[model samples]
Target: MDIKAVQSSYARWAPVYDKTFGAITNVGRRCAVEYINSRGGSVLEVGVGTGLSLEQYKPDMHVTGIDFSAEMLQKARDKVQALELSQVEELRKMDARTLDFPDNHFDTIAAMHVLSVVPEPEKVMAEIARVCKPGGKVVITNHFERKQGVIASLERLFAPFANTIGWHSDFEIETVLQEDALTLEEQRALPPLGMMTFLVLGKSGG
Candidate 1:
């Protein structure tokens, strides 16, 4: 999906996101953050829609969230205020492909359920790698195209409507593996029948 398509689709999703997609994605988010908290440090959540994971972050870790959708970000901002989550440093509206942070800025960067939805995911990966500290890690949770199954057939069927749905059902794991600075460290399957995958990539020398 293009930028406008993502923005519009998320605008519609923002209102009910914490109850809908947020609920469905809760497992992956929890797993990612739990791992992150174990390795505690400054964090950047790329597509932090509605800030569902904000309150879960350990208080010792500094967290900053960014998203392209203003509506989604507003909800996230509201959550931060409501919960008084001091761990959250900020919530900014920024495009994934062009991040505003300096090089090697964050200790960990988490992109939960967002790689397939953004435009130019490789560019997003590049930026993620660029901003990540040399010894830091990046966490990704997403659904990739299944090779064969009833779900694989459904994913293919829904492939053409990516823009409308806001995520490519046929999106591949390799698309987010473009950053040379990052090395794949771990991979695993998530709950709800393993429909999603959790990935961990450590920057070279991290």
Candidate 2:
């Protein structure tokens, strides 16, 4: 997929993406934030679309968000401003594959619905792990192609159209994450939503 094209597409869809995908995403965000809080840490959220998850974050936790779309960042900026959280939240236009923070920088890094859309999942995960303190947590939630059954067939069938619109790779996230030594702490599917996976992973030998 073309990075520029994907960015442009998201920029165009920024206004409606949240409303269209909010139902499931709202649950995903809550889940991600809860997991992060459970681990207790300074947090970073990648691909924070319209800042829907901002409210889910506890006020005591400091957070930084990064996304590639300016328009989407604009919406998120507006949201942070509206909520009077400008001092606590920082949203930047950035690529997940190449995070700007220093090594072992954050205690928790959340990537909600971000990996599947990126061209380099492994690189992004590596960057995520690099900035996380040892034993720190990495939370990821993304739409995936079910291993089997009717849903998988539908995903395969419409993949062409979906690919053109915004969707990217739908490969097994478990296999991908494991390859980079990010141990899966927990994995569960969100009920009634078979296409997505909510996962909590920890750094190896942390």
Candidate 3:
């Protein structure tokens, strides 16, 4: 998906996101947040759409979020204000392909149901690896293309319509695992018929 398409698609979805896509992705979101909270520290959440998982973080955990869509960020900011979520340190408009933070800035980084939606996911993954602290965790939850089955066929069928659908149905997991500095620690199938996957990648260090 191109960046413009992503921005426009999310602008359209922002209004009903929490009740629609957000609800469907709830299981994976909760799972990621719970895992991060257990190892609380400074967190950087990529594609923090609507901040649905904001309040779930432990109060002691400092979180910073970024998104390319202004429409979506507004919703997130509103949630932070209305709920008085002090753990949310800041929310900025930023491109994942070029993160603004310094090297090894965050103890944890989260990308939830977002990689497929962003353009050049490989670049985004590299940026993620760059800013994550050594030995820190990068938690991800996303729908990857099925290898074989009825779903695989459907994925291929919709591959061309990524710009319209707002995400790539045939996105591969290898796209995220290419960063050598990040080692895969765990991988598992998530709920809703296992269409989504949960991954934990630990940055290498002492």
Q: Which digits, one per residue and each the tens of the lDDT, describe model 1 over residues 86-166?
A: 999989999989999999999999999999999999999999999999999999999999999999999999999999988
Against the true structure, candidate 2 reaches a TM-score of 0.92
18-64, model 3: which lDDT tens digit per residue? Answer: 99989999999999999999998999999999999999998899999
Whole-model Cα lDDT per candidate? 0.93, 0.78, 0.96
* Candidate 1 Cα deviation (angstroms), residue 183: 0.8
The residue pairs that clash in candidate 3, if any, are none
Off by over 4 Å in 3: none
Q: List the lowest-lDDT window of 10 residues for candidate 2.
A: 167-176
Q: Under the 3 Å rule for N, CA and C atoms, how many clashes does model 1 have?
A: 1
lDDT value, residue 96 of candidate 3: 98
Clash pairs, candidate 1, are 135-206
lDDT of 2 by residue, 1-206 (tens): 45787687787788898778666567777888888877665888988878888867777888899999889889988888888873345888898888999998888889988787776778888889899888888898888777688777877776665446776534666544754657788888875555667898887656
